[model samples]
Target: MERVNVVYVLLYDHSEERILMVKNKGMDSSYYTLPGGAVEIGETLEDAAIREVIEETGLSVELDGVLAVSEAFLEQRGHHAIFFTFRGKVVGGKINIMYPEEIEEVTWMNAEEALKYASLSTEGNELVNRNSTIPYVLRGKVIHKN
Candidate 1:
């Protein structure tokens, strides 16, 4: 069985009413999502989150807390992917799109605008709504009932 485990950072700067987001091109892309990606082999979850942020957005961030965990099996892709979303605080570094193929744009979107993006995943909404980590499994297009 194929599987992909990843981390997503939700770095909220409430003072600016902004959230760090990344836009990816192509069909496989999630469009606009938090700054994060797949976890490297042998990498810890928190480390993956921190590393992904820098790799994708060129910003150094520290994990504030865990926000949510979502697991979904993409039958079409023939793999199971687990997403670990965390609350992150920018510590240093400038923002830029380091990976052009994977990241098209990086911006501090207004909190409302970020949430309003059409591509915002269901799991993403749940994370912001509760303002905390939620672990849930999604089987295909529908969320799996616990």
Candidate 2:
């Protein structure tokens, strides 16, 4: 059986040209991604997103809506874990990288810029790969499955 995981992408207007993203820590130095984590037992997906975002970025989000749901089988921490990607919006609190051990740096970038930071692995490609159904622009409502 494969492990299940849930992660969220925290997005803000950023003047309609860019969105905030965090560089993951200890993942080959180029593992930058949205702020999110795995869903704990007895916890809802939404709750996990909020908790993960806060833990990773020290920021509280209003969760504008579900951006996408991604399921990928990959080896992490010595096990194959399925990953779920959820996108949300920040509503309050200051932006700070609290989990330096897991998060190295935070940067805001547009669609092209975001993709540049994504990993070439299937996990990263799946995230950047979008279909017609998923809006190309980084605004409004959207959902994706992989």
Candidate 3:
């Protein structure tokens, strides 16, 4: 199976009340998710997160630290992905959809509101809400084994 590395950035506004998120255009339907994408060859995890956030949301950010690590195995797709979610703060740029093909919208929402859109956002919000420094880990689960 192919192994993929993905990076997501959970950026909070100045008040630390809202999180930056993106609506991704998928094959079946659009879904809300943190600003992120696959890590390219020769790129560090931090760089990938920063680049992805900029590409998807048109914002520059400085990552405070890693928030969570998640993994998933897709047997039918013949791949597994390791996701690195980071806590970040916006430093520059405005909110804009830089890439319209993959991303449908960019917006900020409070943790409670964001929970209705994406489940993964829950982990990040929990850490921020509780002021926890430990990173959460999500073990990989295989849908089917051949």
Candidate 4:
């Protein structure tokens, strides 16, 4: 199976009440997620987070710290994905969808509303809620059935 490394940035506005999110077009439907994407070869995780946020949301951010490290197996896809979520602060740029083909919209949503609509597991939602400066790990397994 292929191993994929992805980075996501959780950016909040000045008030910290709202978070920057992207509505992405999935294979079957659309879903809400934090601004981020796959890490390219030779790129560090932190650089990938900053670059992804800029590419997906048209905003530049300085990551404050790592938030969570999540792992999952995509059985159907024959892949294992490791996701690194970082807490970031916007330093400049306005909200815009640079990659229209993959992203549907870029907007800020209240924390509660974001968690409600986000395509994340219950534990994932809780991790976001914690907002801990110390990083946490969430491991998940894929179940295969006959």
lDDT of 4 by residue, 1-146 (tens): 89999888888889889988899999999999999989999777888999999999989998877777888898978889998888889999998888899999998999888867654568767766787666433334568899
Better of 2 and 3 by TM-score: 3
Q: What's the C-alpha lDDT at position 55 in model 3? A: 93
Whole-model lDDT per candidate: 0.78, 0.63, 0.81, 0.84
Question: Per-residue lDDT tens digits of candidate 2, residues 44-128?
Answer: 6667878888887777886544445545556465445544454566778787878777787776778557655533245444543
Estimate the TM-score of every prediction.
Answer: 0.77, 0.69, 0.82, 0.83
RMSD of each: 7.8, 7.9, 7.3, 7.9
Instruction: Provide the lDDT at 93 for model 4.
Output: 90
For every model shown, the clashing-pair count is 1, 0, 0, 0
> Model 3 residue 105 lDDT?
89
Inter-residue clash pairs, candidate 3: none
Comparison by TM-score, 2 against 4, better one? 4
lDDT score at residue 4, model 1, on the 0-100 scale? 94
lDDT (Cα, 0-100) at 12 in candidate 3: 73
Best-to-worst order by lDDT is 4, 3, 1, 2
lDDT minimum window of 10 residues, candidate 4? 133-142
Better of 2 and 3 by lDDT: 3
lDDT of 1 at 84: 81
